[model samples]
Target: MTSQLSADYKVDHFQKKATVVGLVGAAVFLFAAVAPYIFATDVTSAWIKLFYLISLATTWNLLAGYAGMVSVGQQAYIGLGAYGIFVFNDMGLDPYSSVLVASVAVGIIAFPISYVAFRLRGGYFAIGTWVIAEATRQIVIRFDSLGSGRGRSITTYTEDAIYRNLFTYWVALAIMGLAIVATFYLLRSRLGVALQSIRDNEVAAKSMGIKVSQTKRIVFVVAAMGAAAAGGIICLQGLGVASPNTIFGVNYSAFMIFMVLIGGIGTIEGPIIGAIIYFLMDYYFSQMGLWYMVVLGVLAILIMLFLPRGVWGEISHRFNFKVFPVGHQVQPLFPGIKLKKK
Candidate 1:
């Protein structure tokens, strides 16, 4: 009798998961199809940039959020994607294709780097990533194929024409859409549940026969892929070339962390909320000069102190709200019984 009850519980668990996934996928596709037309204006350029940055934060959230591996060197992957467009340009492939190539290449390359980074724990891991980013920057700057320091230019698909601009803008929107959808898909899968288990209690998970290291490695690769595509998307919009310093900058990683931290670390939706807040300030603050950054610093502290869970995290806790519902949820079975997956 107990076994039959457990089987029924399992069915209910999967049922809820399916509903969440279907709802999220439909909403994301609808938004992606509409965002381009709704915010199509020069003045709305900030929104474009927000999409790009949110994609970056999403990547970081995937890594630091699920895997519990807080890396500060994700910029290396971003830089690779940025340069990829130019690399493909030189090879005569489409710039958009370069985004794929860059992301795949970074995911591949990260395997070896992960071997090294994983050797360090906590603070050491963060510092090791920075060192890797610095090394990548120096090496790329010396590569003759990519102009040193001066940076190479990407051939605008339309030579600065209207169609080219429109396409570039749409590409940015598509990239963000892809990132959000991919994250949602991963979060609801068996892998996503496994990742959450590891994040919440590693030793407990390991005792239950979970392969913690392998799971983290896979997530690290996913994070790299997302960050790379984000860099490629943003660079495409302005038709600009990426220099080593520009793409792999330490500041790049810092900004990513800032966005993620402010958005709410460990939650997928937090990154998007944080990106919106960030760009809003960036737009208004850039006009105010350095003082705006001071204000931003203050804002970060206030959010941290008052709302450690971040803006969206707090919202979720307060009202069970979610603009981004990408995680699996279990419902209560009975008032007198413990709530589990069922």
Candidate 2:
């Protein structure tokens, strides 16, 4: 006698849990979007800071955690983004419009700069980026119209305080949303796989026919644009660049590192979590002066020693669930089916 049997299977990237999380997240985002209407301007205005911080952290994490590019010079783009505002604003564009235009300009500029930065690898690449940032700062300051190391204000901003805060808050929220969505989709794409493979093993990624340089350059420019948008938002929030030194300060790089490491590097959710944690700490403890920095340092050390994968990384590892769910999983349509041979 002979018997016939069949087997079936399915592949899935998005899990049920992820769907639930997505719905809840959508609700939260909707609430946040309508916050200006429901909450006081003062309360809604503070979210602008969190929005930019998340934007910065997410881009930095995308660079270092996924692409294996530990750059400490992202402030270069941040400063440029801030200054680009002044350039465009002076050219008769509104400050808000200036932010978008400046970000695109910075992305175009980053393409050529990536060529210079790509020359070195590992620690050299890190140092080269910092050098580039410092050089950029020096060059920017030489332009007397850009405040010459002093500072500048947005002379063309809206006059109403409430409307101004509302607009800025909306822009900030939009930037944060776009950053997260763009990153999520990017990581889900084939290029994201290439980038992660390169991060894990560049030589092997090349052997697999992945165009390492091109992929990295794309990420570089994208990350630059992201940083620039955040920078523009910072400028808008403060009404202008307070000082070139402050806007382009390496401290911003430190903050990026702190957020990515604390939230969990290499994951989309990690940076957001990390940024919120840092934001809370900064809001409450900044008044303590040097002690605030001390606390930050201590917390970083503890997280590294214990939660080496970061808070979200550890949590995800334990639960085996992902809110973003970029990776694929395969399952059998029929749990246990065997073909019989006669």
* Top lDDT model: 2
User: Model 1: runs farther than 4 Å from truth?
Assistant: 7-40, 323-342
- Write the residue-wise lDDT of candidate 1 on 1-342 in tens digits: 345565334333355555776687778667755655676556445556877898888888988888888899988888878887888777887777777787788789888888888899888999999899889888878877777887777863666554565566566777787787788778767788888889889899899788988988998888888888887876777575545787788777878888988888878789988988888888777788879878888988999999999988898888876655555444445566566332
- Estimated TM-score for each candidate: 0.89, 0.94
Candidate 2, residue 77: the lDDT equals 95
Best by TM-score: 2
lDDT for model 1 comes to 0.78
TM-score of 1: 0.89
